[model samples]
Target: MLQVKHLLADKGNRIYSVAPDEPVLAAIRTMADHTIGALLVMRGEELVGIVSERDYARKVILKGRSSSDTPVQDIMTSPVISVNPADTVDTCMRLCTDSRVRHLPVVENGKVVGVVSIGDLVKAVISEQGAEIEHLQRYIAG
Candidate 1:
């Protein structure tokens, strides 16, 4: 079984984050600039929550909260569910589907190591399948 560690090994380790007191608009701008859907909300060096586009649409826009005035802590999802590098692709898929979240922070030893998206899991699975297909073809040719 392919584990998240394998995928992270290829993707590299970078935990993109924003401070909890930061304005929601700032998070939005970061997301836009980085082309990411979510930002991990941090309290200093520690993770506090997660903020996503959904939070902006539902909490800020729908609720009439000003993105420029509202802090990320006001709109973030707290106690965010995270994954570990040891988690398999199947586990990550289940977490994503069950939690209804696209992005997951990879934590190990109480420190954030990387982040994974549903797209990343899908890509890893596809690569695994391709390798298996190549192996089967080679066996047939032999």
Candidate 2:
């Protein structure tokens, strides 16, 4: 099974984050700048929460709140569901499905290393399946 470490190795451990006190608009800008769906809410290297486009939509837009006036912490999802580097892709998938979250922060030794989205898990699974199919085809042809 593919592990979170393997996915991080392939995708690179690049963490995009926003300060908890920052305005939601700033967090949205960061996400837009990176072309990502979510941003880790950090407070001086500590992961406090996570803010995604969905959060903005539900907490700010739908509520008729001003993104520029609202702090990211106000809309950010807290007590985030995270995964360890050693965790399998299958485990990550289960967590995402059960939690109804799209992003999972990868932690190791009590430190944040990276973040993986549901899209990443799906891509890894598809790649693994393709490799397995190729291997089985070669074995059958031999």
| Highest-scoring model, TM-score | 2
Query: Cα lDDT for residue 108, model 1?
Result: 90
Candidates in order: C-alpha RMSD to true structure: 1.2, 0.6
| Candidate 1 lDDT by residue in tens digits, 1-142 | 9888888899887777999999999999999999999999988768789999999999999998899999999999999999999999999999999999999998898888889999999998899999999999999999
Q: Model 1: which ten-residue window has the lowest total lDDT?
A: 41-50
Error of 1 at 113 (Å): 0.8
Please list the residue runs of candidate 2 whose C-alpha ends up more than 4 Å from where it truly belongs after superposition.
none
Query: For every model shown, what is its TM-score relative to the native structure?
Result: 0.94, 0.98
User: How much lDDT does candidate 2 score?
Assistant: 0.96
Reference-based lDDT, residue 52, model 2: 96
Q: lDDT score, residue 114, model 1?
A: 89
Q: Identify the leading candidate in terms of lDDT.
A: 2
Candidate 2 lDDT over residue span 1-142, tens digit each: 9999999999999999999999999999989999999999999888999999999999999999999999999999999899999999999999999999999999888799999999999999999999999999999999
For model 1, state the Cα shift of residue 72 in Å.
Answer: 0.5
Native-to-model Cα distance after best TM-score fit, residue 139 in candidate 1, in Å: 2.4
